[model samples]
Target: MPRLFQVIGRQEPVATVSMTVYLHATSADYAAVGDDYLLVDSRGARGGRGFYDQHATIWSRDGRLLVTTQQVVWYRVTK
Candidate 1:
């Protein structure tokens, strides 16, 4: 599970546009800070795990992540 993030939603078409992301619900407690693989349909719905070792989705000319993924990693804490 990923613990730290700012899920912004991809709202524009640019080299790197600001994204608008909503918070994952209170399901798991750790989100790995790596690329989380994602899958989207023609309707613009994303489907995939929320955390991973590394994720980098390529973007298409239509402003959709070429693939569904972003970098994320498991949260590590020390006391």
Candidate 2:
């Protein structure tokens, strides 16, 4: 299994917001394969005169990374 950690947290909404992630994990046994690495995921939102962002990282079994994904979502709120 992989280990996941949240590097960022949600904040207030604003005009614009950005989230960044850095994958820097290493493994000895798993690192033997090229598919070994760290996976980072990030998300953010802007609304209500503020913005919020969050990030998460997941490593594969033996602390290796083989799969990766990215998702961006936007929503408009009327208040």
Candidate lDDT values, in order = 0.33, 0.38
Q: Candidate 2 vs. truth: CA RMSD?
A: 9.6
What are the models' TM-scores? 0.19, 0.32
* Candidate 1 minimal-lDDT segment of 10 residues: 9-18
lDDT of 2: 0.38
Judged by lDDT, which candidate is best? 2
Error of 1 at 24 (Å): 24
**Residue 17 lDDT in model 2?**
33
lDDT of 2 at 35: 68
Clash totals for all models, in order?
28, 8
Residue range 1-79, candidate 1, lDDT tens digits: 1212323322222121223333442323213323554343322234234322443344333344344444333332221
Q: What TM-score would candidate 2 get against the native?
A: 0.32
